[model samples]
Target: MFQLGKTIVSEDIIEKEFVCNLSACKGACCIEGDAGAPLEENEAKILDDIYSKVKPFLRPEGIKAIEQQGTWIKSDFGELETPLINDAECAYVIFDKKGTALCAIEEAYNKGIVDWKKPVSCHLYPVRVKDFSEFASVNYHKWEICDDACTLGKELQVPIYKFVKEALIRKFGQHWYAELEKVAEKNN
Candidate 1:
């Protein structure tokens, strides 16, 4: 097994263990960070189409990220740089009456207008297309792993398996499914 921060990659990376460190530390990934991933031309087209439809639901501040960065660009690592909202929070986050943040995309999915699919970046936190990229390797922001006073121990579980699994499937499709299945089987 290979452990990188809170992520534990058993013999194969696809079966990597991801435990949410939010309970142990403030959600640094969502609170103060930046993340970028490459988009194949087709993926870019799909994102442009979907984001256009969901644009209105995003806060003006959130929209600024898209405006300033553009939806896609060439990244330093040869991957495409996809803009993310402030601190990488889902563009869909909104405050409740009690002032707690809520995910708008999740809400839309619940309302049936959109499906459970989120942008690839959100689905693959801490990991990105670059992880699979032949030409690039993304470096996602990770503060939880760096926090000195974090409560989670060496073996703590991160609540990201299902989310990551869905994202990997969504981004890589069937070919990777078999590869990941092998990883899961060998590790589990």
Candidate 2:
């Protein structure tokens, strides 16, 4: 691991490969997780503010869950997260005609109904960032559901850092991402 600004990043992000193979996993990460997608404090407020605009893009089940619970909920540990349906699938989860799970909030963003995309955690899949008092730790998340994605990424020769470049930039910044690139280059 190496330090970049305030973040301590794991080498796995530069070494491991992963690209979402949605056709194979059917976006199982959304439906099969024990908890809902993680959310930042600001994202929770954004969801509350934009629920009206994002409502139309959501599925009925998702809407029901949101109404019953709030846009976001506190986990047992007090971390914020999206609500859940039947305590299983994420409350914001939608499905394509092929039954592949998708994010309703992202659908709204794609349609220009909302400005904010889904939660940063959702956007930065397989790359979780944990903030400490002094710095943040960035690491790759491994899940069996993403095995197909790992295989596809290996075939495509795309590393995790490259695949989630936009998200890492979004969470960090252009300069931070550029430094990360230098680190990646040195490693390669």
- Choose the strongest candidate by TM-score: 2
As for model 2, its CA RMSD to the true structure in angstroms is 0.7
> Clashing pairs in model 2?
none
Off by over 4 Å in 2: none
Which digits, one per residue and each the tens of the lDDT, describe model 1 over residues 23-78? 44344444444554435666566556666655666678657777676655555666
lDDT of 2 by residue, 63-165 (tens): 9999999999999999999999999999888899999998888999998889998899999999999988999999999999899999999999999999999
lDDT of 2 at 72: 97
The segments of candidate 1 whose C-alpha lies over 4 angstroms from its true place after superposition are 1-16, 21-27, 35-40, 67-69, 72-78, 84-106, 131-163
Ten contiguous residues minimizing lDDT sum, candidate 2: 53-62
lDDT per model, in order?
0.52, 0.94
**Using lDDT as the measure, which candidate wins?**
2
